[model samples]
Structure formats: structure tokens, C-alpha cells
Target: MSWSIRIGSIAGIRLQLHVTFLFFLAWIALSQGLLTGHAERAL
Candidate 1:
């Protein structure tokens, strides 16, 4: 959990973004861009 950054809180519960989740997101975007052939689509 040390790799996660605190994002915010919701109703006393904390939210965080893990480092692996970021990489997973990047992978998704890259795959989408490759499939669509549109770099802007990755954003």
C-alpha cells in the first residue's frame, strides 16, 4: 500500500491510486490507441 498515493476521501473512507493501477491504465490507453490508430484517443 506504500506505493499508493492518497487521492481523496469519501464519507470518511480514503481513496488511493496504486502504482500498478496507473500502469494498467496506461496499458489500456496504449492498446486502445493502437487498435484505433488515433494517438489522441489514448488521452
Candidate 2:
């Protein structure tokens, strides 16, 4: 296999994983903040 093909595949996989991580981080931050606020209100 050509080096270009191998590099391209690696780059594509890295980009995909970077995007997935950003999505999950945003979701977790939002959800945890909301839960903390609710818990504080209940106290």
C-alpha cells in the first residue's frame, strides 16, 4: 500500500475520534451542570 493511502486513513480516523470526543464532552458538561443545579435547589 502507498504511504499516502495509509496517512489518509489515519488522518480520517483521528478526525472522527476528535469530533466524537468534543460531542461527548459538551453533553457531559451540560448534563452534570444541570444536575448540580437541581440538586442544590433541592437542598
Candidate 3:
């Protein structure tokens, strides 16, 4: 499966976002939110 997407480009340089990185961020936020019981702090 594809893991990243080329969203756009700037000055002939491609800008892409890796799906796994996003998953990692979400996991961190979710775990932190659960531990602290505060959404703001998780972010």
C-alpha cells in the first residue's frame, strides 16, 4: 500500500506527507489524552 501522498509542489520541489507519521502523532495524542484526561494537554 502507498504510505505517502504528494499533496503539492513548491519551486519544483514536491511536498508529501507520510501516513505512518500521522498515525504516530495520533497515537501520541490519544495516549497522552487518556493518561492526562485532558484533550488540550494532549495536543
What's each prediction's clash count?
0, 0, 0
Instruction: Write candidate 2's Cα lDDT for 1-43 as tens digits.
Output: 3222222345356322345566678777777778788633332
lDDT, ranked from best to worst: 1, 3, 2
| Alpha-carbon shift of residue 13 in model 2 (angstroms) | 12
Candidate 3 lDDT by residue in tens digits, 1-43: 7888889999999999999888899889989898888876776
- In Å, residue 30's CA in model 1 sits off its true spot by 0.5
TM per candidate: 0.68, 0.43, 0.68
Q: Show pairs that collide, candidate 3.
A: none
Error of 3 at 17 (Å): 0.8
RMSD of each candidate relative to the true structure: 2.3, 10.4, 2.9
For residue 38, what is the lDDT in candidate 1? 88
Candidate 3 or 1, higher lDDT: 1
Q: On residues 1-43, what C-alpha lDDT tens digit does candidate 1 reach at each position?
A: 3999999999999999899999999899988998999867786
Cα error, candidate 2, residue 25 (Å)? 0.6
